[model samples]
Target: MPFRIFRRVLQLVLCANALRVYLISHSIRRVIIATLGTALLLQVAYFASVLLLVWRAWCNRRAVEGTSQRRRGSDYS
Candidate 1:
């Protein structure tokens, strides 16, 4: 999946230069760029949310681990 994204971003970077030239020469280019930018923004937002959820779950796991560690140490007494 990430490799697919890497290919997409590579394609975007390679195409953007031509897109800039197209933008200056045609009205249709503006609309295409606008649509692509909006779609890219939405994708980025979704990726951020998934990352945030993973981070939150990781923190909760760490907290549980710490509590279990303390309980184990207390048992030695």
Candidate 2:
């Protein structure tokens, strides 16, 4: 009977250890996922800013060209 009780205790200790390890690993996985999500968001924001700058530059160039053409036409007339 004593041997049986000792064996049960040993099993409980092993189970508890496994549960602790699993919890630690789960928490670590969550941290890694959060870090990756933040990095992806930052990258998206960087690209969006770059695209906005390029679009503004293109519009400004078109406006300047249009004004210069109008001036040339008026001068000829």
Candidate 3:
């Protein structure tokens, strides 16, 4: 348990130092940040498109099912 805590503390210190250096160095940070941002934007766009398609498909399936159910009930009456 003690060793685990020590490892975590060491990792935090290293991350803080790296972040400070990244902030101090403008050019490298900008390129890294821009690439990450673009990746996130593209992910959001892809997710939205997939969700819209699934929603349309669900609605179409429900409509078809509802009509078939109505037709079956009418024939039995």
Question: Which candidate ranks first by TM-score, i.e. highest?
Answer: 2
Full-model lDDT for every candidate: 0.74, 0.69, 0.70
List model 1 lDDT by residue over 5-61, tens digit each.
856875675477447756676767665766577567757876887899899999999
**C-alpha TM-scores of all predictions:** 0.61, 0.64, 0.61
Supply the TM-score for candidate 3. 0.61
Residue-wise C-alpha lDDT for candidate 3, range 1-68, written one tens digit per residue: 25577457655654565566577775766656655665566557657877998999999999999999
- Return the TM-score for candidate 1, rounded to 2 decimals: 0.61
User: RMSD, model 2, all Cα superposed?
Assistant: 21.2
The stretch of ten residues in a row with the least summed lDDT in candidate 2 is 13-22
The order of the candidates by TM-score, greatest first, is 2, 1, 3
**lDDT tens digits by residue: candidate 2, 11-76:** 565456545655777675655565556556655765787799899999999999999999999999
Q: What's the candidate order when arranged by decreasing lDDT?
A: 1, 3, 2
**Clash count of each predicted structure:** 0, 0, 0
